[model samples]
Target: MTAERGVHKPNLLVLVGPTAVGKTRLSIEIAKSCSCEIISGDSMQVYRGMDIGTAKITPEEMQGIPHHLIDVLDPEESFSVAYFQKVCRSLIPEIASRGRIPFIVGGTGLYVESVCYEFQFTEAGADEAFRQEQLRFSEQFGPEALHAKLTEIDPETAAKLHPNDQRRIIRALEVYHLTGTTLSRQLESQTKASPYNLCIIGLTMDRQLLYNRIEARIDEMVQQGLVQEVKSLLERGCSRSLVSMQGLGYKEIAEHLLDGLPLEDAIMKLKRDTRRFAKRQLSWFRHMKDIHWIDVTRGENFPDHLADIRAIIAGKFGIPLEYNYKH
Candidate 1:
């Protein structure tokens, strides 16, 4: 693609990476430089009381820049990509109207991509009869049976989705009944075109280094009372199966706490799962062909990396990225 194709779009500085890769710090710098507001892309970070486990940034870390969409959702309330799209859509334009960039930053690939691609969503009215039929099918025939049925109807989507990914499976069947369009077709329609001009910035490090950082971050979280955070959520009556609990560290700790696994064992599992999660995140972003990759391996030279980032944004997205003479 021509430089103009990369350079002329309005700036939505999306800084994403695997967990604990320092996306937060870099994002603060980027947001400050571009006179931008940061919108979160982390799915778990939206929960109101789940701060420690979510590794949420404190007020001090924010460095006085405005942030949106963090700590807004109740843990018990269901959050979907559609909801996130609505929030981002509402915020990005508002930021733009003020002549500031909207920097979408975090580690959640699906949440980030859904907004960046402007994936169209179809409004499907439920057919109660058909919905009841599928619920009965799942009850008597089991989730696998329901998954098999979805496979017959939408093989492509099923190929990537897990058989136990019941929520997505049920959604697929729901769409099939409600709109008479297969889940695959709805996704196809959602791909019609994206609304915003987005600049994707992917952060990276050596695999071993990233994994080490993730484990270290987990250790830090444990010290910072992540277990207490999860315990508090349980007190709030969120079940283990809830989406919030499915988050990497929370799930393992919950299992250990409730099921008799030693705390060390739980922490070990948490660390391992996080590494696996980082791997999956890398796999997910592998096909994101438009991202500009930034590999920050050296510990020092923050300013050098920041400058390189600013130049890339200015050259690629027509934004005048500011930088401190010393900082």
Candidate 2:
């Protein structure tokens, strides 16, 4: 499927699944087989010094396969779907130009879909004063009050957003203030067409087993001193209010340290929240079109799963499968 644009758009292989569904290893193997460079689609992995929490692929794990977009921003810096889309648009073509496929790999459905579907973010410029005012309002009147304001102007969007999601709520309000158009309406009008030929692979497993993996991953993260990871960021003056610090592992652990929550309670909350996050990730991907699902069950032979994925890539995208599997 070539793009309508005069120039040829390269094929994109996207490997997306719920957290701890085993995307990292499989993606590396696929990249090796397809001769591709990976572009991480994860929202949290972009932040530097956030390795353990984000389960960022280490240099050892990457095994010499070039990766883009990980560890690019400071913990205090902000990242957005619009920024992700812009970076990927440039990186994808540059990777293609070098004769390597660009593999968009992560569980961040919104970030990946924004790139694949080519979402057009609102053209309305940011009103810093309005945003600051909304922030102050939230701090003074609380998040619920701020959310109520959104309900007045954009009930549809407010209904979808959590009261605790103050960033998005403020942004939605800012959009209405700037352009007199609701964020939901602006998104509704955006095109969902892709400029690249895409083959999206979704990984899955038995629900109980997936949950078990999530629990184990959380345990491993704790063992890796996830608490210390958050402590270092805070010590460096990174605020809890920053979007990066609000990520799953970092936020839960930060609460224990800063807000005086019990350590065990924080760990439990982290595990529970991570399980819920995985469920949400699955829900998001289910709505995506044209994904080839592969179920990798617990105790299953991994090489067999890799072979299955390789065959799909070759058959669907006409990419050569040169993966050397020593079966």
Candidate 3:
């Protein structure tokens, strides 16, 4: 890591944006130019069988860039922001020690923020019986009903999470149950300080165009056998209730395959939900500090955007990047 004056921390590069906003391609380009080892900030990409739906990066697409935290867990295994924070915290220094900048890239806002800002979560113990009870309540009264409970206890957290995001909702309830203190309150108490010299970039574009891109991506996923992928997971005895199954594509497709909904309807729901999810992701990242935002609406001019981002990184870290404008 090149030492910036007065900044003793190791360098960390983060590229974050809403889904379907071109983070993956841009991140790869930046990493190529910056000598970065990327650690995925995406939450769902960890599950092993969730390839096409989660849009897991292909080996060919990585182009010799070593990536961490992708496809590391079985579908049954649970992953959380706290766990992501712990693992990513360790990876930063290790990657830098190898003389590569640690680049975190994806749209999972809270998970990325926790690592960047060194967020401290409450040490609330889990209650198996309580968890089961909450699960039963959600099952009986529906997820929205359970979310209403969280709304009463911690409205800030509930507002951030989708009603169908039962795992985090239940965890928030559990924290409240254990500590008599709200989860949001604990998060608010965090220092929001980083242990790394950070260079954060956010990509955005026109909303309708982004939504169109999202729908197009979903169409591509369907052609890539997304339904069959979810079916395979289900046939393997992976429950629809698993956190892995709760991801946007998996949830909608599972409903279609198992609940007899039409595939077209499922695709429509997936598209709409994904658009909203992207909006939420943007909302979350915009609230973060020090993000150099770049509008990539004119995707035909990607070289220009890439040059702009290169400049941002070069300016942020006081390092030179090789670029040829006429690519």
Using TM-score as the measure, which candidate wins? 3
* Candidate 3, 1-327: lDDT as tens digits: 356531688888999999999988888888888899999999999999899999999999998899999999999998989899999989998998898999999999889999988998877878879988999999899999999999998999999988877888998999999999998999899898988788899999999999999999999999999999999999999987688988999989999999999999999989988988999999999999989999999999899899999998888788888985445
Candidates 1 and 3 compared by TM-score, better number: 3
lDDT ranking, high to low? 3, 2, 1
- lDDT (10s digit) by residue, model 2, range 146-240: 99999999998887666766777887898899899998897688677878777899999998999888889889998998989999999999987
Better of 2 and 3 by lDDT: 3
Give the per-residue Cα lDDT of candidate 2 at 241: 69
Kindly provide the TM-score of model 1 when superposed on the true structure, using C-alpha atoms: 0.83
lDDT of 1 by residue, 1-327 (tens): 434554444457788888888888888888877888999998888989888888999999999999998889888876777889899988988998898888998877777888888877777754657756766787688878988998998997776555545555776888877777886777666663456666778888899999999989999999999889888888879886566776767877787778888999999988886787787677777767578888887758778888888888887676455576355
TM per candidate: 0.83, 0.89, 0.96
Runs of candidate 3 exceeding 4 Å displacement? 1-7, 324-326
- Candidate 1: list runs displaced more than 4 Å: 1-10, 124-189
* Candidate 3 lDDT trough over 10 residues, lowest sum: 1-10
Clashing pairs in 1: 7-316
Candidate lDDT scores, in order, read 0.79, 0.86, 0.91
RMSD of each: 4.0, 2.7, 1.8
Q: Which ten residues in a row have the lowest lDDT in candidate 1?
A: 1-10
* Alpha carbon deviation, residue 243, candidate 2 (Å): 1.7
